[model samples]
Target: MELQQLRYVVAVAETSNFTRAAERCQVVQSALSHQIASLERELGARLFERTSRRVWLTPAGEAFLPAARECLEAADRARAEVAAASGEVRGRLAVGAIPTVAAVDLPVVLKEFRRRHPRVHITLTSAGSDDLTEQVRKGGVDVAFLGLPTRVEPRAVQSRRLARGELVAVVSPDHHLTDAEMDLRSLQGEPFVDFRAGHAGRAQSDEAFAAAGVRRDVAFEVSSADFMADLVRQGLGVGMLPAAYAPRFHDLRIIRLRDAPERVEYLVWGAHPSPAATAFLELVDHGTGQARDRPDPDGPAG
Candidate 1:
C-alpha cells in the first residue's frame, strides 16, 4: 500500500529470510513483519508463506513483486532526474557488451565513467552481440557495445556504429596453411574454432563462408576470446578474430583474410534513456566537456 511496505515485501521476497530482509531494510524483524502484515491486510491477500525454516512468496506476492520493483525504479528515476536538473547525476547505469568490444578499452572507459559520475551505480554484463542488443532494446541495459556482421544492423533500438573491421585467421605456428594472405576458400575444409552457431560473432564467419560458396566446420563452438585462441594454439582448429584484436595473441600467426567477414561495432541505447545513461553518452561522445545533447528520449534511438 505504501512505499516502505512495498520495500519490505520486496526485500523479504529477494532474501527469502525474514531476518536477512529486515537487515537489508535496516529495520527490526517485528517492524518489517508488521508492515508486511499491514500491507497484506490492506490488499486482502497474503503476500508470503512463512514456515519456521523457510519463507517464499505466495501467488499474490509473486504477482505483486514486479509492480513493486517497477514503482521503486520509477521513484529512483524521478529522484535521479531531479538531481540531474540540479547539476548532479545519480542513478543506475547498466552496461552490456559482447566479449570482444575493441572500439575502446572498456576498463579504462569504465574507470573514467566512475571517476566522473561517482554517484551513479554501474553494472556490466557480457553476452552475445544479439543478446546485448535485445537487452538494450528492452531497457534491461542502459547502453551496450555490440558487434554484428556488415549485412546486419541492430534494429528496433537506437544504434551508432563505432568501427568496422575484418576478422583475421590465426593458426598455430605448425599448421600447414602457410600463406600470409588467403580468402575464405583457402581455409575451406579446415576445422574452425568459432563462436556458437546462433551468436553474432559466429554469424560473422558463417555469413562470410556462405557468401564465398564454401562450407567449413565449426569444430569448437566457444564463447570466450581466450578460449578461441587457446584451441587454435593447440592446433585443434583455426581461430578467427578481429584484425585489431588478434595481435594480442603474440605467439600465433595472423593470416590476413582477403575476403574476410567484416564486423561493425555499434553503440546502442534505449529510446527513452535514464539521466545517468544520457550523462554517460555525453562523456563518451564529447570527452569531459560540458554535457551535450544526447540520450534525449524525444530523439531517435538509432
Candidate 2:
C-alpha cells in the first residue's frame, strides 16, 4: 500500500469513526472509506467492523494499527532528515590537502572556520597532491587543496586558485650560498636534497633547472618537506621548498630564487560544493588574496 494509505489507516484507527477521520485527513468521507477498503483488500484483512451505530476494530485492525503508526513515523523521520541534510549547515566535511599546504595554511583557516560554524564536523587528511586529487575525484573527499597539473576530468570537477607560493632555496645559515638571493643558474652543480619523483614541487624544480640549463647535484631523495629541511639543516645539501614551508624551521636561511617559477595551490572540488565548502573557499580566496577581480598571479606582495 502507498504511504498515504498507511496515513489514512492510522487516522481512522485513531478516531474509530470514518466521518471524523475523513474530516481530520482533509478528504471526503467516501474517498477515505474507499482508500481504507483498498488498504484492507491489499492486506487481505478487514481492518474495521462497522455496524449502523458503532465502529470497532477487528483483530487484524488492532494488529495493523501499531505497524501503520510506525510506518508513518518512519516516513516523517525520513523527510525530516533529508530536509535537515539539505537545509541545515551542520554535517561532516571530509577535506583533503597536500602535506605542505596542510602544514602551512590549513591550521589557521580551519581554526577560523570552526569558530564560525561550530556545528560542522571536519575530517582532514594530508597526502601528496596526486593522491589528494585522486581522493577528490573518487568522491572520497568533499574538497581538496591540490597543487596544479592535476588531471581533473572535464566537467566533473572545478578548481579555484587559493594562493600562489613559490619554491625558495633552503640552506643552513653557514652555507656559502645562504647570504644572497640565488638565481636558478646559481644552483647548478650545488649539492641538493630533492623530493621523490611524482611530486609536484619536484617536477617544478626539475622544470626550473631545465629552463636554467642547470643540473641539480641531488644528494638525497626524500618524500617529506620537513625531512628535506632537516637534511639541509645538517648541511647535507641545499634544497628547494615552498616559501611558506621554509619558515617552519629555525637556523635555516630562506632565499628566493630570482628566476624560479611560482607554484600555486588550488581549492578543488566536484562541480558543485556543499554550502560549508563554498564558505571555506570564499574565506581562503579572500584571506589569500585570490578573490579580487584581477588577482595577482603571485598573490599579495609581502
Candidate 3:
C-alpha cells in the first residue's frame, strides 16, 4: 500500500477515533476513513471495528501497525541521509596517482585536504599513468593526478594542471655523462633502465628517442621509479625520468636533456563528482591543495 495509507492506519490505531486520527494527519475525516477502508479491502481483512462511541483495532490492524510504523521511520531516515549528503562533504573518496608524481608533493596535498574535510575518507592509490587515466575514464575512481605527455584538451572529463616537469636523464654519480647536459642521441650505445613498455613515461622516452634517431639497449625494465633509480645508481643502466622525480635518489645524478618530453601533471575528474571529491577539487582550485610546480632550471618548463 502507499506510505500515506500506512500512516493513516497507524494514526487511527493510535488515536482510536477516526476524526481524531484525521485531525492528527491534517486530512479530512472522510478522506482518512475512505483510505483506511481501501487499505482493508486490498489486504482482504477489516483493520478496525467501529461503533458509534469509539473505535478498536481488529487482529489485522494490530499485526500491520508495527510494520507500518517501521516503514515510516525508514523513509524518514532515508530522506535525512540524502539531505545530509547534499549539505556536507562526507564520504569515501578514491584518488589515483602515478608513482613518480606520488613521491613529489601529492602526499602534502592530501594531508591538507584531510585536515579541512575530516569527514572525507581518502583512499590514495598509486598506479601507472595509463592505468589511472583508464580508471578515470571508466568512472572507477573519483579523481586522479595524471601525467600526460602532451597538453590535454578536456572532453568527457575535466582537467586542471597541477604541476609540470621535463623528463631528464638519470645516471650514477660516477657515470661519464653525469655532469654533462646531453640529448637522447648521446645514449646510443648505453644500457638503459626504463619503465615498463606501456607506461606513460616510457612512451614519452620512446618518442624522444625515436625523434632523436637514437636506439639504446633497454637492459632493465621496472614499474616503480624507486627501482629504476636504484638500478641507475648501481650502474646497471642510465634512466630517463621526470625532473621532479629524479631528486628522490641521493646516489643518482640528474642531467638535463636537450630534447626531453614535457610531462604535465593534471588534476582530473569526471563531469559530476561526489560531494567529497568536489570539495577536494575546490580546495585545489582555491590554491590550498598544495599546488606545486617546481621546474628544473636546466630543463624546458611546461
Candidate 4:
C-alpha cells in the first residue's frame, strides 16, 4: 500500500534473501520483514514463499515486481528532471551499441558528448543489436546505437535513422568473388561466414538471399565483425560486413553485392527517456555548435 512496502518487496524479489534485502534497504531485518508481511496482509495474498535456505516470489509477487520497479524509476526520473531543469547535468547515462556499429567512428560522437556534458557519467555496453534493443526496452539501457529494423517491439521504443551504408562481401584475395561485382545468388553454393542468426545485420543478409530465392552454406556464424573478417582472411569463407569496416582488413577484398541491401544505423531510446538521453539525442541531431544552440521542438533552446 505504501512506497516503502513496495520497495521492500522489490528488494526481496531481487536479492531472494530477506536479510540481504534488508541490508540493501539500510534497515534492520525485523523491520523489513514486518513491512513485507503488512503489505501481503493488506493485499490479502502472500507475496513470497520462504524456506530455511531460500526465498522465491509467488505468482502475485512476480506480477507486482515490474510495476513496483516502474514506480521507483518514475520517482527517480522526476528528481532527475528537476536536476536537469536546474542545468546540472549529473547522472548516469547507460548507452549500448553493437560491436559492428561501434567499429565505425562512434568514439567521435561519444567524445563530443563527454566534452559537453562532463558532469554526466557515461556507461557504454557492447552487444548484438537484438540484446541492445531488449536492454533499451527494459530500461536497462537509456539509449542505444543499433542496426536498423530493430528487434525490439515498436511500441516499446522509438528510433531515428543515424546513418546508412552498404554491406560488402569480403573475400580473400584468391577467392573467385573478388574478381567482379556479383549477385548474392552467386554466393549460394559458396561456404560463407555470416553474422549469427538474430543478429541485426544477419537479418538483412538472410532476407537478401531469401528474396533472391537462393540458399547459401554458412560455414561460420560469428558474434563479432572483426572475428568474421579474420575468418574470411584465412579463406575459411566469404563474409558480408559493413562497408565502413572494409578498410580494417588489409588482406581481404571488399566487393559490392549487386543487389544487397544497405545497412542502416538507428539511435533508439524508450518513449520517455531520461534527460541525459534527451541531451545526447539533441547533440546527435545537431552536430554543429550553432545548430545545437537552436531551440528544440519541446520548448526553448537547450
TM value for model 1: 0.91
Per-residue lDDT, model 3, residue 251, is: 72
- Cα TM-score per model: 0.91, 0.63, 0.66, 0.76
Decide which is better by TM-score, 1 or 3.
Answer: 1
lDDT tens digits, residues 1-302, model 3? 89999999989888899999999999999999999999999999999999999899998888988889878855754554574567855666789987777223667778888887787778988887777877877666788877766644334667776666788888898888755688778778999999888777687788778888988788899988888888888889988887767767877888898888777677788776766677777776666535345632433221
Would you list the C-alpha lDDT of every candidate in the order shown?
A: 0.86, 0.73, 0.78, 0.78
Worst 10 residues of 2 by lDDT: 288-297
Judged by TM-score, which candidate is best? 1
Query: For residues 50-120, could you state the per-residue lDDT of candidate 4 as single tens digits?
Result: 99999999999888899988888787678778999998666778999887762236677778889988978
lDDT per residue as tens, model 1, 94-125: 99988887766677778888998899999999
Candidate 4, residue 157: Cα displacement in angstroms equals: 3.9
Q: List the residue pairs that clash in candidate 4.
A: none
| Root-mean-square deviation of every model | 4.5, 15.3, 15.0, 5.8
Stretches > 4 Å off in candidate 2: 1-87, 102-104, 149-156, 286-295, 298-302
Question: For candidate 2, lDDT tens digit of each residue in 59-78?
Answer: 99999988887677557545
Q: In angstroms, how far off is 126's CA in candidate 4? A: 4.3
- In the predicted model 1, the residue pairs found to clash are 158-301, 158-302, 159-302
